[model samples]
Target: MTTVPRRFEILLVAGFTESDETPPTSAHALRSAVVEATGETGESGYPRYAGNGMEADIDPATRTVEALLVDGAEIDYGLSVRVVAAPAT
Candidate 1:
């Protein structure tokens, strides 16, 4: 039998409110999620979206990054990224 410690998965989501702009992506688009280390509260770089006064946020509990634009606004496009942990050998 093999023992494995419990880990978390991170995901990112974006919502557009009738806006014609490309969604923002992680600075490290290559690698999205990271394993939570011992007391590791690392912060990732969130680049500006054409300086449109927009910013990205993350929810550690839900492990999700959501845009704060949910006020009866029409979300045209959306993106959901699933981050999976590597299998143990």
Candidate 2:
């Protein structure tokens, strides 16, 4: 990989936590290409820091993205928000 700083691919992760307490087991993993591209178009490019968390329960089998999780809480379809890379630190 190139050692270019601030130049890396972000990832979008989600989880299903209705019963478990320790951590989530089932999850959705997706490349953050869409978020990166949109950020570029919006003039706010990659390496963004959302401060809070952004995630969604994306089901490939059902072709659905729902149950957004932000700041450790379940919310509605919140994909129309800024999605950044990493743990925001």
Tell me each candidate's RMSD, in Å, in order: 12.4, 12.8
Residue lDDT tens for model 2, 32-59:
4221111211122222322225434332
Candidate with top lDDT is 1
lDDT tens string, model 1, 6-73?
44333334433346365334453332433332332224422111112222333434434443222223
Q: List clashing residue pairs in candidate 2.
A: none
- List residue ranges in candidate 2 displaced over 4 A: 1-52, 76-89
TM-score of each: 0.22, 0.23
Q: lDDT score, residue 58, model 1?
A: 35
